[model samples]
Target: MKLSDFKEGALGGVPIALGYLSVSFAYGIMAAGGGIDPLSAVLISMTNLTSAGQLAGTQLIIDGATYFQIAVTTLVINLRYMLMSLSLSQRIDPKMSTGERLLVSYGITDEIFAVAYQREKAPNTPYMLGLISLPYVGWTLGTLLGATAGNILPERLCSALGIAIYGMFVAIVIPQCRKSHPCLVVVAVAAALSCLLKYVPVLSSVPTGWAIIICTVAASVLGAVLYPEEVDEV
Candidate 1:
């Protein structure tokens, strides 16, 4: 929790924040276009920092979805947070207060989790706090500005930027998958199942949120069972 540790964490986190800021800008424009208020857009980016869940939730809102549907969809889309939280909890100081844990949890995201987990030594509480704060600030500010200027952007340009966030997701996930056979299998299975669900008669009407949950869970479980971590030969 020392000042030097906090500065180091911020330095470590700068690259991640820069990448996230760009993706979040697109999310802000989408949220605004979907009728979310500017403040709400900023809040979502600041609190959730989850592009897919935010996009799904915002579209559901624009479609006049029931409150229950929005809640369920968001939970399904964000289920991975549970795993990330569990991993991060292990890295945090054992003496850390529950309140500190709760506050840091708000900033958990794929990129943040990856960087934190990869660190050789666990980050101190102050460092984690600073790491979270910098990106959260960028996300909030980007969302506020994007929402305010959403209408002024040309439609084609906005659409292209919107696609960039998904590209970022692919860029992160694909490299990790390439390095692990089990991960590759899981991704392939999920893609196949998703495609089938989209084209099959009865499943075609299933809620996309539910379909994604089912596919992801099934694939991950299969991957874990079929490809348990390799052990070196004696």
Candidate 2:
């Protein structure tokens, strides 16, 4: 609960907050274009804190998909968060209470997890709270701005900004891929599988959410099998 710890956490989260703002802005545009109101879109960002899940869910809503479909699709797309949460649990200060841990879990996005996990020791509750706060606010505000802008912005401009989310993803992964052969392989395999799923006759009929799940799992397993690292040595 130290002020210094909280300040450090907030400072560490600034980059992540900036990234979330750009990405969530794109999500807001997409949501608004699909007929979601600004408030609803902002609320979705506040509650979900997931890019893929929110985007897929918004698309499903536009398509008039059943509740069951929305639930399953979101669950499939967000299954990685389960593993992230488990990993983060091991990195949280053991003195944190159950309630505090649950609160911290809400902020455990991929970027946050990466930063928190790299710390020399487990992150205490105050640090985690500070880290999550700014990003959460940024994401919610970005969605609000995007949604409001989507309603008034020119069609061409909105269309152009639609690519922002993908661009962000590329920005995140390309550096790591360049540094690691295994990472590159995984990305390539996932891209190829995604393309195949989009083009192949039978597979093309599968929902986009399922396609993503299959591609991610298949490529990840392939990468793990191909590059079994020496864990103890590391």
Candidate 3:
């Protein structure tokens, strides 16, 4: 836990923290509106550290979805984190022990992964901790505020804040699409599949989790088939 490493990681996390504040705030408001108390909403943010998963899970809870449905929905949405962690394993110090890997793995969100992957050095435990710390705090704080005070905010404003997470995602993906044709194609395929699943009558019946999983796998496969060499280069 070198001070320098931690500091650098914390600095890298600032933007992510800022982005999380708005998104989590939106989550908090939604949770509060859905009958989850402030403490419970904050607890969910603290423990989960994910945007989409929490939002979906909260909605399910509000809808009185069965436990199995909630678990499967959240799991399906978050399965990508496993793949992200695996990709990170390649860039991290190979000597990292199981415990350190587990701890570091807790912080492996899409935004955090993007920042860490860009680092020139192999990210260490301390660095990863520092990177995740602020975002975690921001998430919790935002949820607290939203759960407690969000009702005072107008509906239109709340709606606007809720889209911050999506904007963050677009920010992450657009640059990659510009850099690589394969990446662009894969993203396109995934988006198209998602739209089809959401809109087409037959596919619309499929569960959200399964639809997302299908899109992710199918898009990657099609991209690889179309650009085997490019995929291999990555």
Candidate 4:
């Protein structure tokens, strides 16, 4: 929890914060397009650090989905965070108090988790806090800007900006896909499943929430089965 450690962590988070800003801008635009007010959209980004969950939830809200439907859909989409949290529990400094751990857990997004996990030693409270701080601000600020822009900008411009989110996703996935066959296979399977759900007659009727769940589970299982890891010899 030293000042130096905290500063270093913040430095490490700069790139991630920049990335979040771009992605969350798209989220804000989408939320506004779905009829959510700027303030409410900003609040959503502040509270929920999840891109997919927030976008899906916003769509459900626009569609007039029931409370149960929204709850289940969000839960299913965010189920991976539970596993991420569990993995992170083992990496945080042992001296981190229960309260600090609880606070840090609030900011455990995929990017944050990856950065925290890469440290040579366990991350302490101040480091974790610093790491999460800028990205949190960037995400919220971007959402605010995008939401406001959605109100002021012409419909055509907003529509164009909407594609930024998908572009960001591709930028994230392509490098990993290039390096790992398993990642490539999984991405392909997931994309195919998504397209099928969108185009197939009977399957096209399936809800968006359910389609995501099915694609994620199916792709993960297939990857694990096809690319079982090799054990190292002692």
Candidate 5:
């Protein structure tokens, strides 16, 4: 709650919030395209919070998928968060209660995980809490506002801003690429593999769902094997 803590959270969250807003705006339009109500889109953004999972779940809903399919799909897309939460567990004060951890887990995302992992000082609980709060609010509100203001905005502008999310991803990736040759190799290999999947005939039909799983698992394994963390770095 301190101003200093809030400032840090805001600084950490600004890039994430901007990226989230653009991506969520796209999601809003996609939800509308699928004939979902604006309120439902907002609810999806707030509750699911994971962009890939929500889009997958929405597609499932549009397809009239069975409950089992939807449930499995959601779990598959979000399973990475389990790993993220575990990594973050070691970073938190051990004295924090189960309930507090559960609450914080709701805001766990890749950007938040990256920021938390890089912290040199033990994060104040309030600052960590703030890290999630403002970004979550921005994500939810941006989706809702985008949906409510649907297509009234120019199409070209929306399409251009959509690139901002990808740009944000590149911003994260480029720094790590500079830090190590292995990181650059991992990204290059992943991008090449993705292109093959996108272009090649038989593999082209692979759903976005499975593509993410393949890319994430392959890249994580490759990264660990090629660039194992040094024990003394801690």
Candidate 6:
């Protein structure tokens, strides 16, 4: 919780914040275009900090879905965060208080979790707080700007910016895939399953969020069974 640790974490988080801006920008556009107000879109980013979940939820809302549908869709899409939090628990200080753990849990986005896991040692409270701070702000601010400007921006530009989010995941995964056989195999299997679920007539009826959850669990279990000794590298 030292000032130095917090500053170091904030510095480390700069790249993450920059990356989030692009993705959240796209989310904002989607939300506003779908009829949500700019302020509500910003609030969604502030509260959720989940790109996929927010996107899915907004789409459901646009479709005039029931509250239950929105909840289930988001829960399905974000179910991986529960697993990430469980895995991160092993690395965080066991003595960290319950309140601090709750705070940390609130900030556990995919990129933040990956960055924290890559650290040589578990980060302390202030460090973890600082790590999540700017990205949170960037996500919210991007949503604000995008929502307010969605109508002004060309549809082509908005669509292009939407692809930026996928690029961030690629950046996170490519190095690990290259360095570790397990990572490569897991990613390949997940990709294959995703394609199969989308293209195979029998499975194509599955909801996108549910398909993602299934693919993730299947890939993760396979990796764990095949390489029980290999610690995650990224």
The TM-scores of all predictions, comma-separated, are: 0.86, 0.87, 0.82, 0.89, 0.75, 0.78
Q: Give the alpha carbon lDDT tens digit for every residue of 7-44 in model 4.
A: 98899899989988988888898888788999999888
Candidate 2, residue 102: how far the Cα is off, in Å: 0.7
User: What does the lDDT read for residue 9 in candidate 3?
Assistant: 95
Where is model 3 more than 4 Å wrong at Cα? Answer: 201-203, 232-234
The candidate scoring highest on lDDT is 3
User: How do the candidates rank by lDDT, highest first?
Assistant: 3, 2, 4, 6, 1, 5
Against the true structure, what is every candidate's RMSD?
Answer: 3.2, 2.5, 2.8, 2.8, 3.7, 3.3
CA lDDT of each candidate?
Answer: 0.79, 0.86, 0.86, 0.85, 0.76, 0.84
Tens digits of per-residue lDDT for model 1, 146-186: 78876688998888888877898799679868777677788
Better of 2 and 6 by TM-score: 2
- Residue pairs with colliding backbones in model 2 are none
Clash count, predicted structure 6: 0
TM-score of 4: 0.89
Q: How would you encode candidate 5's per-residue C-alpha lDDT over 23-59 as one tens digit per residue?
A: 7887787777678889999999999887778877987
lDDT of 2: 0.86
Model 2, position 88, has a per-residue lDDT of 80
- Name the regions of candidate 5 deviating beyond 4 angstroms: 1-19, 52-80, 114-121, 222-234
lDDT of 5 at 172: 64
Score residue 15 of candidate 3 by CA lDDT. Answer: 92
Model 2 Cα shift for residue 33 (angstroms)? 0.7
Whichever of 2 and 3 has more lDDT, that candidate is 3
**Top-TM-score structure, candidate number:** 4
Task: Give the worst 10-residue stretch by lDDT in candidate 2.
Answer: 225-234
